[model samples]
Target: MTDARRASGKNHYLWGDHCDGWRLIDGPDLSLREERIPPGCAETPHVHHVARQIFYVLAGELTIQLPGRTVVAAAGEAVEIAPGQPHLVRNVGNQDLRLLLVSSPDTAGDRHAAEPPGLP
Candidate 1:
């Protein structure tokens, strides 16, 4: 049986600087989550060894810093990150940034912190 899940009523966790995340689906092969990032907050740069991820923005703006460029996704937009890609997520807007993070093959135990590209 499948049940409805909402961030407000799901398993919530905090990350980064005052960020919030709720796991909507946590299966062994796939993971889905709703994440909220306060303004001016950013997650540490990291890479997934095998899992590919997609960030779909639900509200505000999402800025993803990649190796040589930065991608910005506003409401109704999404960014796709390939496996082994080192990227950093940031909330550069004034309001709260809300997005759905989807990972295939799951990311648990596969994340490795990495230095942002272009940094000496």
Candidate 2:
């Protein structure tokens, strides 16, 4: 049997400067989450060894910083981060940023934090 999921009814946890995340789908092969990032805050740069992820913006704007450039994903836009690519997500707009993050093969223990921007 399949059960419908709703963000309002899902459990949320705090992450990174009061940001919130709700796990919409949890499984071994795939994971889906809805996240909220407050203005001026950012996630740390990191990479997944085996999981590839796509981040879809639902509200406000998201700044995805990569190796050589930064990608601005406005509402209704999405960006993908391939495995082993170091990246970070930030809320550069003056409002909260809402987005859906989908990970294939689940991140699990595959996250590796990289040095922050402009650092060696």
Please give the clash total of every predicted structure, in order.
0, 0
What root-mean-square deviation over C-alphas does model 2 reach?
4.5
TM-score, each model?
Answer: 0.90, 0.88
Per-residue lDDT tens digits for candidate 1, residues 1-120, read 122344346488878898988888999899999898999999999999899999999999999999988899999998999999999999989999999999998898999999985522
lDDT of each: 0.90, 0.86
lDDT of 2 at 87: 88
TM-score of candidate 1 against the unseen true structure? 0.90
